[model samples]
Target: MIAVSDNLPAGARQPTESGDCIDENDARQAANWVAETLERLSRSSFRSSFTLSPHDAEYARRKGRELIDRHAHEMLAQRVGAAQPAKDGRQTPWRGHPVFTAQHATACCCRGCIEKWHHIPRGRELSAQEINQLAGLIMAWIDRDLAAHPAVTGERDGWAAPPENPKDAGAEQGGATPQPRRRSDAAGHLERSRRHPDNHHADGASGFIQGELL
Candidate 1:
């Protein structure tokens, strides 16, 4: 299970605050890496133009969240100094998800970069809490990048479009639908109000007008 505290084993460095796992400085560095990587890739004639589709972006987010849930221990082992061998005893193959790509780009993928870029030096195993926080930072960076550059076809600039009338969402589900009042009803209400302001108050004609407009 992933721990959510900064508590660490003795001889390990105290973890940074969870909220500061991915700060403005980290985000800035990720952005620069993203820009430079793409620009460099563009120069390669053999490099195909590849951008993550909406499906790919969604997959990356889902996988990232799932990784944090199911693979925290393994991730920590690989990231920190567990010295665990791979299944084939060589090296674990990198998962080609965009979040992984972003993790590499953002220097959040391993302890070496985490130490160099994030200032989290490696001497002892990372606490589960730290691993979880690192996962969150990588996921956040992936989400931020995806939001900034959306897939061309599915959404507008990585944001889902708002419904025409957001307030009317409830109206679809057994809510009282407001019926438009006829012109005659409006005219009659006006006449009643004009004929007697005191009478209008007494008969609640003003109230009727308010209800009708709504």
Candidate 2:
């Protein structure tokens, strides 16, 4: 987990009450490791044709770092009404702080890895069972890491719950009930969520009229 700091950039989003650049990096590493670590997960957990190249990994990492530097700390500042995250010249990551730390400290955040875990970005390209299997692999990876990591195991206050599996939308998480939105999401939103499009993963073109992603 990253320490909270006085480092910040101009025109950044406000920081949250609490911050964790360290945690963000951990999640990034974990996500990447998870993708590579458990290559034997069920076929449904991974697409036979899908694979991440070294170039792809590097590109994603760089983008993740850019995202963290540009928007993460500021968002943290606003969340807790706290001071913005100050720049520390530390290495950046794909996952940002505040929210990333707010999530599981051990859960992975490498977008490429998560893509393997859920295959949501490519969901439309595959079957439902494949997606569920992919999600399960991700779930299993996080559970295993949480059981193994010191920060996750020995702490009562630092550890938080992981996100509900989309496949288990109606399932319980850690003995707690889950709630889901009643309405189906917009196609454009789904596309944005999946990080579709060529230029970037940003929601969509800014100031442009929205259209159905599919």
lDDT of 1: 0.42
Predicted model with the maximum lDDT: 1
Model 2: weakest 10-residue lDDT segment is 82-91
| Model 1 residue 27 lDDT score | 51
Model 2 spans > 4 angstroms off:
1-93, 96-124, 151-214
Backbone steric clashes in candidate 2, count: 21
**lDDT comparing candidate 2 with the true structure:** 0.30
